[model samples]
Target: DAQAAICMVRGHAAEWNISADKIGFLGFSAGGGVAIASTMSATQMERPNFLCTNFGPSLMPVTVPADAPPLLIMTSADHPNVAAGLVALFMEWKKAGANAEMHIYGDGTGPYELMPETGETTTESWSRQMLQWLKSKRFI
Candidate 1:
């Protein structure tokens, strides 16, 4: 079902005048699995130029392609149940020789807050940080 997003992106990438090469996917929580599935899927166009998971589980036994796009994993120390998963994912990507970066926010309190405004709490500032990450990837 999540791959539908990828399919939709591929279906409309050109019509929308967006460069497919600049395409990327960002997902939160369970949506993170979708983003991973999209990137790991066989269809090339569905594989975004970048894959980002915000406070989501880190995938395992995934065969990252040689051309795998940069991967960004964001998590919070407050969520002990999921914190280690992100690190596992980072290591998995590195083991597979994929470009990866991770940002661990918060100080052992609070939850993952998506789409935080520019001047909110540390959890809220995640969205803003994502923008900077995009720029660093030269996608902006």
Candidate 2:
């Protein structure tokens, strides 16, 4: 379904007034695992230009492709399983020489929210940080 979506969007890029090369995938929590899976065995036409996984780690073993898209992983340090999984995914990307960046926020232990809550910490700034990363990578 993810590959189908990518193909659909890319195929209609000009009609949609979007650049095919700028297409990316972003998933949160379990959806992140889906995003990762989408890339693992994708053909060139089905691959996203980049991937962002927010507090969502692959549920299964990962095999990073040599031509894997740049990756951005965001999670909270206190969320042991998520943090560890994201770190492992980042390491796999690095081992494959794929561009990857990660942010393990120190203050929280669960999925970060987009809206700021009372006494919010840097975890809420993930969206901004992600935008900066995208810009830096020229993906936007």
Candidate 3:
């Protein structure tokens, strides 16, 4: 899924007059995990035996720029696994000198779900906050 997404994003860069080297990925929940895994795993030289043989096409080289855009993640503190995974991913990005930030909200009113109503406060305009972060990073 990550490879496909990256490929598709890269494939469209030319039409937008944007360089693929400048593209960055943002994902939520399960998609977040996949994005982290994909960015790292795409650099491997050997194919894993666990993957199906029928998988088509190797991706473009994983060239995480020295100035790669920031990664922002929001997870629930009540969900330890989600928090842990995000922290670990953050550590990896930090070690690679890639910018990343994560927020784990305590006492979230919802679990693993995004609220649609105006009264929702768990995620509390997380999408808006993400947009702000992206704007701060010059990604938008």
Candidate with maximal TM-score: 2
Model 3 ranges off by over 4 Å: 16-22, 43-69, 111-120
Please write out the lDDT profile of model 2 over residues 82-114, one tens digit for every residue.
878888899999999999999887654465443
Q: Give candidate 1's total backbone clashes.
A: 0
Runs with alpha carbons beyond 4 Å of true place in candidate 1: 58-61, 111-119
TM-score of each: 0.81, 0.89, 0.63
Candidate 3, run of 10 with poorest lDDT:
47-56
**lDDT tens digits by residue: candidate 1, 1-140:** 55667668778889999876787888887778777766787477566778889878644446667677899888887776667777887887888888999988765444434424334665557777888999998988
Each model's Cα RMSD: 3.4, 2.7, 9.1
Indicate the residue-level lDDT of 53 in model 2. Answer: 93
Candidate 3 matches the true fold with a TM-score of: 0.63
Flag the better candidate by lDDT, 1 or 3: 1
Ten consecutive residues with minimal summed lDDT in candidate 1? Answer: 109-118
Give stretches of model 2 more than 4 Å off. Answer: 107-109, 112-123
